[model samples]
Target: MTLRRAWVAVAIAAVLAFPWAAGSYVNYVTCLALTYSLVTLSLNWVTGYAGQITLGQGGFFAVGAYLTAAAVVHAGWPLPAAILLSAVATGALGLLLGVPALRLQGHYLALATLFFSLAVPEAIMALPSLTGGANGINVPPSTTFFGLHLSNLRDAYYVLIALVTLVVLVDRTMLRSKLGRAFLAIRDSETAAASVGIPIEVYKVTAFTASGVIAGLAGGLYGSIAGYLNPATFDLWLSIYFFAALIVGGLGNVYGAVIGGILVVALPQLFSQAQNLANILYGAILVVVLLTLPGGVADWPRLSRAVRWLWHPR
Candidate 1:
């Protein structure tokens, strides 16, 4: 198998082995990495494959998380049911929002999403009864997902891995289908795609909806993982972080999406010393990656060539 195919499996294997090799804290960190990777892959569906930019992913995430938590806590919904329904509902919301915003291309759409990211927090705060205001909802340990109780970190890790695998498979399948082709066509040139009779607006809206589903799934899983839900967690900065993670992982690449997702969670832990320095370091890493490896850390072959060229300059 090609590195492209093997990298994801390798990552999964490494994570699976991590619980045995590392301590509980390390295992927990790995679980967090796997969880965030879903968010990165969700953006991969939007900015990477669909060629549309979104700055409101954090808002979608917030909705999914809160909705999932509320369903379980108040409505007495099962964990899997809550996640699935929240994802579908979020996707519907995405469709509604995308209709008007998709008409505006480039920076305009981005600004619209940015506003969405900012607005969600206030909306959460406004709906005190439903959202728990600033205090947020604490997710009870889910015991109803196919009778598999998530009582320990290991159990959660397994569930998270299953979700990640599902997302990756769906992503890869779509990437190879006609729908994926339409997204690429629209991304490359809207006029060109329209000339071929592709419904640009419909596809764009679908892309946004699909992106929302991914984020919603990730968000629901994240809420369960953290055992908490609050609007503050899904801030504008988190959206920026998601975008940065996508770039660092390599756009239009599934393996890169997972790798980038891992880094977003891992980076903070590595720089846990100063805390403030982590942001600076992340900015520096992003700048360096942008300048040097536009394909991101997962683009190993390109990096190898660069390394060789540097060593054997003509």
Candidate 2:
């Protein structure tokens, strides 16, 4: 295999082996990292791939999580069934929202999604009967997977790994297909893409719907792992965090999503000594990277080339 392919294989192997290689704390952290990576990858479908900037991802995530929790607790549905329903429902809502909202571009669309993100939780809160009000709802015991129950940290880590692997595989496959090409074309130029026989509106809505499904899946998986659901957990800041992860990782690449996702989730834990200091440090790092390396970590090859030229004085 080529160097890139070799690196990809190594990364996958390491991710798969993390539960066995790490302690309880590390395994927990890895699980969180995998979850964030899944969300980031989903965000990339619209933000990175389709060139749509949405600030409502947290809303969709919350919807999925709450739906899963509600279905299991109130409706007495099975875990897998609840999760599937959440994905479908959220994806449908996303398509409905995208159909009308996709007409706008840049900041307008962003503002529209922002409204959705900010309003969703409050709306849930207002409906005391359905959403358990502001107190949030508790998740029930998790279901068994195969023959193993995911109650322990080690078992939970394995479940996250499996889900993340499936998501990443789907992302890779989609990016190599016609739909992926349509996304790229739309991102490049809508007019140009439309002129070439691409159905711009259909594809845009589809991308948003796909992004919703990914977010839903990630959210359901998260709810299962945490065994709890809270409106605050899916607040607007969460969307900002995911967006920051994408910007830091390299928006258009899957590897970048994974790397960025891990860093975004790990940074707060790693620098929890002083909250303000951590934010300052994190913001500084982001600014420095954006100014010096616009393409994020995934563009390391170009960065390396620049370093080599500077050293050689060529």
Candidate 3:
């Protein structure tokens, strides 16, 4: 355990030094990757840990982005307060949706969430006065963080790193608690969990609510980073990409979220020359990963060892 902790510490230190080691462009990209990592981690809580399939994560994400932007742009709220309120609002929305729809299992639940993903952007367009409709809204640069104004990607990277670290710690603590065990129980077998006195309905709703809060937080951070908000930004493809990240990284594994986030953000840039074909390539990669590594890219070490043993017959 000590060795493992040491390795984790080393890895974190490396991540912290990445922006300085790399060029400005790389720093920008890493900032975006870190934001996506937060989103993936949030998705992991509900889909990976609790076995809930939600396609409306984009909607929740947008809720956070737009709410924060509106609060900051119109209401003149401070950045931190806007972000916090956006997360809380999104969590409440998640609870409202989860209470009734979570009872629907399998495809039914997915379809319900899919509709939600479809609805959010339309709702934004319908309310043109606030959301700016198709024209999009411009977010002001965040200034005055505890009396220190941030002015560059490097500063934002530090804030993101701190946020991600807090998320990791909270996530680890939650999964180790009895509440997390109940989530796993519901995921594995809802009926059996209920029979064993696990409040299935309550836990499922709580999981969804928690997931929304995290996604909303990520969205708020993203808006601050991008300094723009649009209905198109949180489309169906975005939700699909989040799901793909979860599968590719390895569901139910924390490390998988990190791996998935880096790939999702980096892959498109790598294929920028063939922008039209990026989605096709992403789909192909996802299929290959699912077929060859059901446990995700996180299982590559074990897979490699097994293959080597097979070949050498040791």
Q: How are the candidates ranked when ordered by TM-score, highest leading?
A: 3, 1, 2
Between prediction 2 and prediction 3, the one with superior TM-score is 3
Tens digits of per-residue lDDT, candidate 3, 95-202, equal: 998898766888888889989999999999998888899999988875434443333678778888888778877877788899878888888998899999998888
Compare candidates 2 and 3 on lDDT and give the better one: 3
Model 3, which residues run further than 4 Å from truth? 1-10, 142-151, 302-314
Cα deviation at 65, candidate 1, in Å, is 0.8
Task: Pull out the clashing pairs in model 3.
Answer: none
Give Cα-based local distance difference scores for all models: 0.82, 0.80, 0.82
Each model's total of backbone clashes: 0, 0, 0
Report the lDDT of model 3 for residue 223: 81
Q: Tens digit of lDDT per residue, candidate 2, span 123-159?
A: 8788767678788877765565454454466777777
Ten contiguous residues with the weakest lDDT in model 2: 305-314
Worst lDDT window (10 residues) for model 3? 305-314
